[model samples]
Target chain A: MAKKDDSPDGLKLDRRNFFKTTGLAGLAESIAAPAEAAAQSTPAAVGPGDVPVRLNVNGRQIDLMIEPRVTLLDALRTRANLTGNKKGCDRGACGACTMIVDGRPVYSCSTLAIEVQGKQIRNVDGLATGDRLHPVQQAFCEKDALMCGFCTPGFIMASVALLEKNPNATPEQIKKGLDGNICRCGTFSRIFEAVSSVKGGQRG
Target chain B: MKAFAYINPANEKEAVAALSPQVEQSMPLGGGQDLLARMKDYVTQPERLVNVKTALESTVTPVGGGLRIGAAMKMADVAEHPEILRMYPAISAAAIEVGTPQIRNQATVGGNLNQRPRCWYYRNEEFVCFKKGGDRCFSPQGENQFHAILGAGPSFIVHPSSLAVPMLAYGATFRLAGPKGERLVPAANYFTLPRQSLRMENVLAPDELLTHVILPAPGNVKSGHYEVRYKASHDWPIAFATVLIAMNGSVVKEAKVVMGAVAPVPWRSAEAEQALVGKSITEATAAAAAEAAMKNARPLSQNGYKVDVAKTAVKRAILRAAGIQTA
Candidate 1:
């Protein structure tokens, strides 16, 4: 791992050296004047630093103080105590970190928590009610669509988004829609069946 | 990933002000897909990150006869947009071929265009390649089955943008916003070669933001993109080609053929385009054009098969653009 010298002094020095080398010191100075004034005017505002971030998730507003580098996946799982989303390949090659953001399924691992503030974030944990599962979730359970169950949450989110986007999605559409999520147990046939079965509002 | 200061600029000017034009100290964050991955791998250690997603324009608006796609627009939205799908089908095809649905929902057009080459040698910290400010290109002497086959020299890394080839074939232009001012660059001159700059892939300065991709209206041109990948789903293509031909009744009036994953940049074959001019697209004509596309390919020892694969992609793209069924 790289030793992060991200201190304010270190960052300031880096910027100064960069400006010196790039011959942008004049422009940088002009821009920094107002920024420094704004910083002085604020009341202990921490930005470009770890601070409180509010997220409207599912239906509730959750607050967490985390560094800007923290991804939405980490913030959801570790900070908010919502662990339904799994981190498969953190670099976005895998879809295990899929979550619904404002009706669209995105790789939570790749999304920064600071970027999605005030957006309606949804995860697999929010799919089930007191005694009933979401229609898509119920479909998966009846069809035995998952074996390992690690990739199920992400698959469920993607399926929900797909169904919401195209209510009467064809088999080809289902295949293309769920192409992002990968089931390690090779349960694609059952998963497709489940998604297709629910497309017509079929119940278990 | 190392802890870094994140600045959320409310506008494009603030974002550009937060960025350093010459040095790589600060980087503009798009979807944070590519930047975060590199940060996690310790490949890039930027002291600060400027979040430009919120600052830049994220809407795809119609301008003149063409459509202007915001650099911050998600890949999924861009691929599914009605105008993009109807007018520029090749761009949508190429965008949909990128990684997967989740990735598409999160990735942005600017990020896709500026993504670093996924050369394993350059990605791995153990192997210091020329692209990574090292002495020599390890792919030239190391495992290079997935490396470039056409453009080889000091560096053999191929451009990894799926949308670039199609955009180039459509004669798209890019809009860049910087502290100085906003400027337009043609798609043809957007991507740079290894000889031009070893550290950067495109001509985007560090302080400049790739704001918009302006696609001129596709007038009388039928375009198609064909990609041949080892894995049909999420894997990058082994070779892909985007062909745009202006048809006059049954004959080709003008042609633009660009191949991806074959060179350092989007490899445009003037010879292939010349062969398609003033001729109908037949199996024989398509094959001849395809052959001309890769006639000067200098493949590495392990990537010799890519020459044929690229030619087949070119042939299929031409046939598809002409509405011919090769199967």
Candidate 2:
């Protein structure tokens, strides 16, 4: 048994204090080991490097260590665990990773994660209450706007953005506005119906 | 994806200073809707990524003579801008007709103007086309259905800038910031032919950043752009035309005809302009101008239809500009 250094007036020598002094140093060193290892592993400053980013995603402040290569889709799915944004084509062609960035609908798959640090990020996960679904989500379900449902979230988010921007959007505008998102299941007619119905329903 | 560094400068000077060294291996990111996708696809792997989105210096404002649209001004904002709608309606229309609403919302005007071509061979990683420093142009012998039928040489990829066509017609100029300072280049002369330089598109140097697009006062010219595409959605067109006409009582005084998706760069038809100038824009004249525009078209085996498409597009554009409905 190790002796405790009890120099205080009334404090008594205890085994707990003796063990804590020695073991606490080891625990602290172990806790700090990862950070030191990370710092040592990274290359020195040749140019500007990956910055620590703090973003407010879906009303939650998230701190993440992201490289310059990390896209918004990567940050959402990997770091924030918001997998509702599916990585479809991973290109700008398919809008599977659509999310409301600063009240505007954007393809998260093509957007850099660090670019959206301070902007408000709203994913499909933020579209529902405890037991109730959003009107667009409900409309998509009722209209059978999705077959595989892989592209459903993106379509739904795009619809919400469109309806919010132009509630009375004409059929031509609707077709033009939703031109970016692609559904491989060939449920575009139903998706259009769902969005158009929302426009009419909102006006009503 | 290879590991890369990131930078978010507060101002242009800091950003420029940060970008002093790695111009060749570094790239500035705007909305990242296009650049990041290209990076992820391994088409471009920059060692350092400069994030200039937060640099508030890039903003569109009504300036002295006309509108000074910032380089990072999103395409959606430009399309919906009231002043642009009033002055350059064709530019707004072209902006609206880009990829998609989401893309327009995120993609900057400068980025749109600076975007790479959408040719299938150019985009595909497997095929080593002429644009990628390969031996032969795949579109010549391979599937050249969407290839250019005019102003094409060593390469056949079409210019992808919709706003650029309208900008050229509107007499817009680009303001670029570089290692030296700010310099202006006419939008019409910004795009270079692949024959001139197969590896590059615009006249921008390695360290130069497109800062703003300066649209001259509308003056007395009536300009309009009309694109005829295969798909109404997010696809580039087969042929499009931008017509800027200066009329003197129903008779054309000066005409500028710029065609998009017709060549390696935006094809400006001086012959079409010459045919229209000092002449009334009648049905016969419109047809004549269209014929003059497509006279030099040398179509490939698959893209012979583009000649007719370009002619029809030119005719329709002239008619639309003249307020004469053909449909």
Candidate 3:
């Protein structure tokens, strides 16, 4: 065990000590008071507040009052209650927030809901018809391409877009096309197998 | 991200009128690929965001013998444009190396060219580096493996655009619209070094918006782009090069060699161009040009590998442009 130095006990100065001391709290409060006063002195211009933002998602009209800072991913998951798209790196690094907008896949997390008002938005939830699963979904289940199913939705959406563009994609194309999405469960081999199993294979 | 005002203008005039020269007061929203990321990280807090994609032109059209590309055109559309694929293959090749399919489909040309540097010290809000108005740069003393090797000064950030390198090689001219009206600037003069202004990367004013890029008609030139990346799919390249050479018979008449991801801006290597002109492009000429490209490089303590990688990029670009396959 290491012996503690007890000369002046300067180690006792911490968050607990700051709260216990009287003049220190006053010092902190006094320091924060000026910042608050400065903020009030110069108020930032604020408009385009929570307004009626409308988006056409999955062929359905959705109207909600949200702030301009709210992204399309938040609008889908929180306001519209469509949580099919996941918010994985809110920046554009990961593909977990991918969704088809105007027949092209885009990172929903990076897109502003206000900007995509009239564009078509499609998520993983819109793939199935009634109870029948999409062919890609069925293939994923058959090939066991998922473990915990966190990255499955994004992969499925990417696969749908890739096949629609190049149905007869070679192994090289498949490797390049789905490189955006990552699978933590190490199911890439199975996912590739599932994507290549679609019938009517031909490049569009 | 802090709450901000949003505006969608009816047309280009309205859009330009809505924007101000102050980046903090208002900013034009392109694809939001870079701006939204910075906002989420609390790096920039603009009070207003104006949607410019709705107002700007978003198509690529034929003009004269060359092509006129709208600044708002998506990277996917630009990469897949038939004429671009045939006439300017280097542009398409550079576009393909930007990001994955999702990013390409959403990111715009103006945004891609004008995106902020990807330096880790600058991207993270905790480090107040020189790029963010701080006094010192963290990369020179700290982790600097990915920093710039050429044209570096107080800041060591590598330019992050994939398209800018090829555009300079192709001799493209940019059209910008602002409160002072429109002006045409050559692509070579668009980018500036940190010595000029440490805050911004290019000549674009906060109130100005890039409208169009006009490429001169392709002459008797062979162009190619080659990028060397740690990851083949999505990672940014360690070094990349674009070469455009005009040949008379089997001898080179003129050449333009520009390297990216190894400098503060896209580096045009006049030394390499001098080595290539008036010589037949062979294994010897390509290797000589490759060596000459790195003659002026001043690599940092940790980024000497970039010099070797960039030399290989120049050699490969020349070989590929000359239709030679190197295993």
- Chain A of candidate 2 gets a TM-score of 0.74
Candidate 2 C-alpha lDDT tens digits along A1-204: 113221221122232553456442342333321212213332222222334555678898666554546678766675555778798998878999899998999998888776676789999988888778888888888888999999998988888888888887788878877888999999999998888887643523
Candidate 3, residue A182: the lDDT equals: 82
lDDT of 3 at B254: 93
Runs in model 1 deviating more than 4 A are A4-49, A200-204
TM-score on alpha carbons, each prediction:
0.90, 0.88, 0.90
- Tens digits of per-residue lDDT, candidate 3, B40-140, equal 77777787987778779999888888899998999988888899888888999999878889888888999999999999998888888777778888898
- lDDT, residue A191, model 2: 91
Candidate 1 chain B worst ten-residue window by lDDT: B125-134
2 or 3, greater by TM-score: 3
lDDT of 1 by residue, B1-327 (tens): 667777777778877888886555789888777788888777877778887887788898888899999999999888888889999999999998898888888789999999999899878766767766778988877899988987667799999999999999988999999889999999999998888888788889988999999989889889878999988787889999999999888899999999999998999999999999989999999999999999899998899999999999999999999998854
> Residue by residue across B8-52, what tens digits does model 2's lDDT show?
665565555556444337777776766776655555566777666
Model 1 over residues A1-204: C-alpha lDDT tens digits? 357554534323233453455432333333322222223322122355655666778898776655777789877775666789998988887788899999988889889887788789999988888788988999999999999999999999999999989889988889888898888889999999988888554463
List candidate 2 segments past 4 Å from native: A1-51, A199-204, B20-24, B56-58
Candidate achieving the largest lDDT = 1
Worst-scoring 10-residue span by lDDT in model 2 chain A: A4-13
Q: Model 3 off-target regions past 4 Å?
A: A1-48, A201-204
Indicate the residue-level lDDT of B107 in model 1.
86
Give the CA lDDT, 0 to 100, for residue A204 in model 1.
34
